[model samples]
Target: MISAQNIIKTYGNKTKKTQILNNISLTIADRSFTVILGASGSGKSTLLNILSGLERPDSGSIRYADTDITFLSDSQLTEFRKEKIGFVFQQYYLLPNMTAEQNIRMGADLAGNPDYRETIRAVGLENERKKYPDELSGGEQQRVSIARALAKKPDFLFLDEPTGALDEKTGRQILAYIADIHQRCGVTMILVTHNQNIAEMADTVIRMNSGRIETEQKNQTKKTAYEIAW
Candidate 1:
């Protein structure tokens, strides 16, 4: 389980500081799909960054099981993230020169995971493995990005607006792939998005407003990606 206690984060100096997260505390169960839902500037993304160890909280403790990552040094946190966390963002940050297979391999190599092709197949990119980023559609590139992240076999997968750049159909398709991957791999998935429709697919939904958690709900019956009212 990932547990965070009293997380407080801010930007800028004391004179003109802007608080991003305010005393946020939450727990994410192992191998569960979680959604952080909020409008823009609601601090959902900042909270995700802290929870995933991409950023540190000014005053809080973030623990993954028994390990408290809040105290880790920069280099230690870097190694920790490299080993245990995978991330996908709205932007496909693939190297233009690399093939889909090669880009996925870059992540797999980090964890000595030679079965990177399996991730490609999991994301339904078997036929496009040799294709470069420029040759693929927006949705295909995002699939490649997801596959690349999964290739590392991380315990937790953090995605920020994974489908924000795509159209409705493409977004749904991407979400379906992500849902399938979570079910198959049992990876803890934490997704940050503003769309309430997307929250229906998660086991847990955390709603944030103005740097604070407005509500957190557990879905008694989770919906499939296709069932969500996107």
Candidate 2:
């Protein structure tokens, strides 16, 4: 479980501080699909960064199970993230010159996963392993990025607008791939997006407004990617 309490975050200099997260307290269940929903500047992304140990809160604590990561050193945080976390974002972030297989290998190598080919197949990119990023379409590149992240076998998968750059049809396809991976791996998947439609696929939904959590609810019957409206 990931627990956060009284979390507060601010930006800017001391003379012009702007609060981004206000006294947020929440717990993310283990091996569950969670969606953090909010508009732009609602602090959804900031909260995801803090919870994933990418950023530290100005006040309060963020605990990944029993360890309080808030006090960890930069090196410690890097090591922790490398070992336990996987990320998929709006940007594909694949190397321009590297082949899809090489890009996926970069992540798999971190965790010594020799059978990383399975991840390429899982994302339906087995046939395009030799293709470079420039040779693939946006959706296919995103698939390679997702495959790379999963190849590390991370315990927590953080996705920030995974389909923000894709068309509706491609977005649905990516979401379906993510849903399938989540079900098969049972990793704790935390996704942050402004799209309310995406929340229906989550086991838990957290709504945020103006830097604070407005509501948090458990879905009685979560919908699949195909069932979600575009």
Candidate 2 similarity to native, TM-score: 0.96
Off by over 4 Å in 1: none
Per-candidate TM-scores read 0.97, 0.96
- Please count the clashing residue pairs in each candidate, in the order shown: 0, 0
Q: Ten consecutive residues with minimal summed lDDT in candidate 2?
A: 115-124
**Reference-based lDDT, each prediction:** 0.94, 0.93
lDDT of 2 by residue, 59-150 (tens): 99988988889988999999989888998878889998899999999999998899888888888888899999999999999999998889
What lDDT does model 1 reach? 0.94
Please report, as a residue range, the 10-residue window in candidate 1 with the lowest summed lDDT: 221-230
Instruction: Write candidate 1's Cα lDDT for 60-130 as tens digits.
Output: 99999889999999999999998999999899899899999999999999878999988888888999999
Model 2, C-alpha of 43: deviation from truth (Å): 0.8
